[model samples]
Target: MKDNFSGHSDSYSKFRPGYRSELISYLVSLTKRQQCAWDCGTGNGQLAVKLAAYFDEVYATDLSENQLRNATPKNNIQYRTEQAEKTSFDASQFDLITVAQAIHWFDFDAFYAEVRRTLREDGVLAIVGYALLQVDESTDKVIQKLYSDIVGPYWDPERKYIEDLYKTIPFPFHEEKTPVFHDEYQWTLEQLMGYLETWSAVKHYMRDRGENPITLISETLKQSWEGFDTKTVTFPIMLRVGRL
Candidate 1:
């Protein structure tokens, strides 16, 4: 199924967590000098702008035009509307490449080939994704249940693909798992519901069922958020970085 991200671009940019500055700094230092880089599936140009800040140029590509339009970065970052698997970058032209939270939605075989083609010898390839907020057992119990019972089913397809991460992908990347990072957010019940509705699962479910997931998720989260403070929430994040 086509990933429907256009509708949630605004929320994603606002709410979705970004890679750490430490990680970004590491990405810049990988080549040991400024060089050309590509930020594939660069949703809203978050990492692309960072890549451009150090690299000579950054080719930031995404399938979502609205995300490109919404990004405002101060760097030599060129935005393109292209799918990750079918980008038209010159072969062996990049010194570094990164994908943030988007590898799950790609044709891995084609993407890996593209990475191999575009990256210079010993070029860095960083493919990373983070844990979802309120999607864990250690956090609020209600939040965990909501994710498992409500969002889990719809997200299973993509989640299953990501399970093998660096193991299944045959790219020449050195893999390292980051120490889990945590984030805290202050949200009202309504705000929490809004976040839930922005999830791919909820959006896709809404499309298929022809019902307001907003209303449903809101009601459900409201009933569930009683024990926990809706205003204060903590989210633990786990990230796996595959670097070449």
Candidate 2:
């Protein structure tokens, strides 16, 4: 289960993404029994640990033990190394289920069936996903080139959403986008490099070609920024949900 992320633990933990409180509040409001929630694909348990503060219990599961190691040692968070397609929890066990940046890696049909079997009738299933990044027009031009020209071809087609495709799946579902606000995080050159190194597309590209992505990324970042400080990089995230 933990095979894919076997050796990238440090890159993942230090440079992984996180969610906003606004998204969390919205998810809680949708659930009647916010007392118990299950955080599916709980990478590093960032969102789940925060959720534990809002709920009496949280069952945050992931296939990667590398991720679970950073789950903050929370007593309220029942961390488990369970695949989304094959979790051990009983039917209607959770009042809410949150899937953050990791849903793109799921087996949708199997995952949906499990969600159907596990969530309470009124439970909310908030699925969140982030994109390459957002920045000012000048900065965005460079990022856009990187996304479309350099990085786009290598993305896992199995992972990316084929617009409106999930709607065709046989699950009772509803879709909603979070507030259209950008999240800005400041990054030093090294910190920014670390973030890019964590991207699976970049990792796979280098692996498939037997080239070092970090070296290229470092060279590119240096060339692009004249005198870079901790400038902001905004990322947009969207969430869709429904009761099963």
Candidate 3:
């Protein structure tokens, strides 16, 4: 089955964590010039919107029309309906190119070919991903059980690239060492549930089994969240940065 995200664009836009400003600043620091950046697979423009502050222009592309429709618009950001592997822009057009949590879905050869074509000789390419979110120990255990036991099998095989932090992807460029980064969020039980519902595996489980898996663990999670006005969740952000 194809990896489809159009159906959950709303939840994705609302619940998916945004990158830290420090991360964006770090990526910007690597660029020779901030004239242009292309944010490939920019679901809801999370990274694209952040990139707008640094680049003179940001081209954000996604294959899903619904995703682009829900993207936050900025004066410097241009949202486009285009595949990651095939964009219409000319050669050597970007000072930087970034992919946020969506590189696993790409046809690597085709996408990298396009990247080599569009990126300037001095341009940088950044691929970013976040590890699983963690709440308190008890709550995390409950969520981990749900992830590993309940929805694990439902996740696409492509998820392994992210699980390994994209170590296996053919990254043929001068690599750069990046500082440690994490995206942190404070959320109530309800908010946590909303975020969990946005997982692609959870969505797949619901569609395949015709039952919401979150419902199976809701009471357990609530119990674990007891006495907590809000829970702190953190995802360790992973980056693969290189120069062309």
RMSD of each: 3.3, 2.7, 1.2
Residue 140 C-alpha lDDT in model 3 = 90
Q: Cα deviation of 97 in candidate 3 (Å)?
A: 0.2
- Greater lDDT among 1 and 3 belongs to 3
Q: How many clashing pairs per prediction, in order?
A: 0, 0, 0
Model 2 residue runs over 4 Å out of place are: 1-3, 162-171, 174-178
| Per-residue alpha-carbon lDDT of candidate 1 for residues 1-244, written as tens digits (9 for 90 to 100) | 1556888788877766555566677667657557788989888988887677688888899999988888866658889999898778999888888887787778878888888888887777777665556532433565555566755676647665455543454455676555545557677666666566667877776777888555644555566666665466555434445544
Candidate 1 lDDT at 195 equals: 65
Which candidate has the highest lDDT of all? 3
Ranking by TM-score: 3, 2, 1
- What are the models' TM-scores? 0.81, 0.87, 0.97
Winning candidate number (TM-score): 3
Per-residue alpha-carbon lDDT of model 2 for 97-200, expressed as tens digits?
A: 88877666777788888888898887888876666676556556665555556766776764346233233334357654445544578866677677777766
Model 2 backbone overlap count: 0
lDDT for each candidate structure: 0.70, 0.73, 0.90
Q: What TM-score number comes out for model 2?
A: 0.87
